[model samples]
Target: MPYPDKFNDSYSETKADAEKLVMRANGREGLLTCCIRPSSIFGPGDKLMVPSLVAAARAGKSKYIIGDGNNYYDFTYVENVAYGHVCAEKTLSSEDGAKIAAGKTYFITNMEPIKFWEFMSLILEGLGYERPSVKIPVSVMMPVAHVVEWTYQKFAKYGMKVPQLTPSRIRLLSCNRTFSCSRAKEQLGYEPLVSLKDGVKRTVESYSHLQAQNHRSISKASIFLGNGNLAKTVLWEDAKQTVTVLLLLAVIYYHLFTCGYTFITAMAKLLSLTALFLFIHGMLPSNLYSPLLSLFICCIYLLSND
Candidate 1:
């Protein structure tokens, strides 16, 4: 299919314009330029595709498939994409290879096209998250996407974040975007350095931090703390509150305990500080400092015992 004369978003429009400029500059003033179009590039350290998919999964929005879920895509692994670029550069620099590759565009991939939804399922499942099960047709979702886009445009200045659901994105999810790399194989000697399966595995392993297990009620801290209320709030459980408590405790220790004051004087000062901290904490929102309050209570109990 030929390139569309217009694009739905400025991102796609600018990218198309840039590619055209690069193609136009190919043979001018000894410049050897070519476009390496990697299809649906993915893998570890990908800031766009994987993150958005994971975000949707976390947000409970990944339950529905965008279309019939039969859309095939050539999802290129990051390493394979790098290899493709290397091949292109080597071919462009070589005398024989440059004859065929210098001015042409090449579609690079892992050569293992998979059903788009299946690939999405693999990543989600690998990360201990549920795969999309409900299928919604593109026709049904397009209008919803349009509404969402319009709402985002209207409320964007009021701190409404840009939405993921858009007409172009919906089309991208539902379309068959597989590409043949035969031209690249014959001209540039390009081949994927990593298999698609391994790529997906590596990508999943890289995001262990975002695994569903970590987001569950039975987190590591909870398990270690015997699932007590303090277990969920103390130490490393809530990092922000833990750090704040530690800083406060450190100040109390250095300013009061280390001053060579009598035990009664130090205890009196500590109680006064704790009372003031609790008073201020009570004035704030409940969720904002509830963990701090719990930590402070625990500290007071421990000090009483000491």
Candidate 2:
């Protein structure tokens, strides 16, 4: 339970408590329970870490490092977790090893501790993202992270997903935490199948679609005015496109509300245009018609307004 000297706010208190529950159940008759604490689990099909990191990278928020980049973190590959569990099970079931493995706790990891920021750089660079270089003091980051977490907690009842940069996450990033898997290695015969480099490679390849090079970063104003990358590019990437969209919106607004058209007449005219569109759509060949479908759909939306 000793915390690192540099950081007072140690991460994973909840998980630490859960680990204790297994330890408490350890000596119960006919029961075999042991806790496996895996650090920073990352791999393919990882919905939590991978997606959140990628989202931050895509948002250009991954360009800043909290505090010095020297903190060591134990990162475990997902497959290694599976392997560790299997080894634990075998050790628990085998009469020869049961005494050594049962009623115990083990730290599961790749046994390769890297500087936390360096690990982030590896994942980001592998996924064609910019490695975070700008250093921000933890004192500065903590307040911002606190505000973000508070805001999220306040609005979470309205169905908001918790953001990645919480106070605990900041502490984890800015502090050192390297767990020993020596006991697991000696007792359960658990060895990491995936090296850190190999695991990172697999993770990056799994998320090819989220590569940073494929996207264009934007400013906060652009994001607020527009919605996101997809929305910005589709609407206002080109000046002509922006103008066209605005003009169309204005036209629709004018016809529906500004002009002296009755609701019934507008509805009737909208239906007539819709019928004409369907007629043209039907006449066009499949290959030729497919690409223009979105434009026609937009036109339908425009007509429906008036």
Candidate 3:
């Protein structure tokens, strides 16, 4: 599926086979051609999926799960994907295989279907980032994501980065997208070379710099050490996280009291604000140290908005 600001995601497979028509036309010229489609490929060397997730987590934009967190997806580990390729290559070279598997497409995966958000949580927590707990139902987020995508499309020439909350991306997140690897298993004897857990661990370990604890510890000294102790110890234990929660509360306070906005209207507005924040936060360049700190600054900026 194509995410906002990217025809690449939607067009990748076609692009990968851009010369397929030529190959097909010149086929039986002793050409054995096949395509291996791997789902959500991730592992130590992954350049897209894992990096993007880490960026969102560090930016505090991964707090909201865009659905019920029940969507099932197949994530293919890099090693497993490579193994599938080897199987395909060997199969294509065999005596009985040349005519049979050529000009075919095979879906390769770890073959373990996991709830999408659970998979996300495992990766996040493994890297020491907090797992997402808030559920933003697709109904609330879809329209917002669409607007982000459309806006990016319109303003890309003016330096808008491709938005991360594209409607296509919401669809990808909020839907079940598991693929069966039975064909590859039988035809090519392809088996996953690594389990999903190990793959996630390896991927998380590969990105040592993004480790969540790398953030400097926030000052924990509270003004009222005894009376404020309860909220401090139980709810706002982490000073930085507490600051964000306070910001959220402040926004709610202003809308409910000062602004005189209707309760429902205030809530709708809050939800919209949350979505916009996630969109901008997720689009931030996952650079070294800069955007990470900028994310906390943005959270503090939310107080000014209130």
Candidate 4:
């Protein structure tokens, strides 16, 4: 096959070049190229598309759902996509290969097509995050996306480009783009080995490593924010006071609630209260404080009922 230079940038040119290669390789004995177009390929360690969305959600950047979020898309697991390519290559090179080569173009994806919002919710749940609450229409985003794309293009001429909410990207988000994988399944016996849930689990495991890196970044940010000894001293003192209050509350709750001996219950309550107080104090000026406070309240309620 003749490799076309810079084919990734131009789909039409790439398809034409690929067709020529397929025609030439027809009835040939050795190697043949098969083009497998996969839909939204994603898995563990993915840094683009879905993984980017996941990261944005975690960082609170993705606050809104585009359109009604009812659009369906065929999402293919990266490993399954790879396997399809392998199968295509193997089938094309086999002795009775004309069966595989005759007008063959495979739409490789997971057999199941899922609604966009449902998939997003699954991803959020897998990562222990809440689903997005806001929704915006495609019509509303069009003008904004146009302006952003125009600004980006204008800046590109000056060799200075900025991130923009692009029109093409918005269109993709709004559209229902589900691909048929039945041809691939029939011809190559291809079946997705990884379910969406399993794939998300793998992705979450990879995200745990990234979270450790993020923790170090947050620690550095705290140091930077508390620039002086006075700031540090004030913060620590506030934290200590909060801890003392929480400890007292915990002791009262445990004695009245838990069946454990008074001493053990008091100690357990004291330690939990101390940790919760420090965490709450540290998270002030951040959005996490309210949720953490609510969680603590719930815990107290449950303990009292016990």
Candidate 4 clashing pairs, residues 3+ apart or interchain? none
- lDDT tens readout by residue for model 2, 1-306: 342345434345556666778878876887787778788899999997877777887766788889988889999999999999999998888877877887777899999999988988888888888899999999998999999999888867655566777888787789888999999999989999999999999999998887876677666666675445445646566543343355445545656786679988766765665455445444655566555655755775687666
lDDT of 1 by residue, 197-263 (tens): 9999999999888888887445565556655436645846565446556756865885476667787
Clashes of each: 0, 0, 0, 0
Q: If both were scored by lDDT, which would come out higher, candidate 1 or candidate 3?
A: 1
lDDT of 2 at 41: 91
lDDT of each: 0.82, 0.77, 0.75, 0.67
Candidate 2 lDDT (Cα, 0 to 1)? 0.77
In angstroms, how far off is 47's CA in candidate 2?
A: 1.0
Candidate 4 runs further than 4 Å off:
1-30, 211-306
Off by over 4 Å in 1: 218-306
The candidate that wins on TM-score is 1
Clashing pairs in 3: none
lDDT of 4 by residue, 1-306 (tens): 244564423444766777677767655674455567788877875777556665665445566788988899888888888888777877766757546655467788877789877777766666666677698999999899888877767656544445537776777777898978787887776889888778767876767654423432324443455533333443553444444455556656666566466777666766776665655554464356556666766886787677
lDDT for model 4 comes to 0.67
TM-score each candidate. 0.69, 0.66, 0.66, 0.60
Candidate structures ordered by TM-score, highest first: 1, 3, 2, 4
User: Which candidate, 1 or 4, has the higher TM-score?
Assistant: 1
Error of 1 at 113 (Å): 1.3
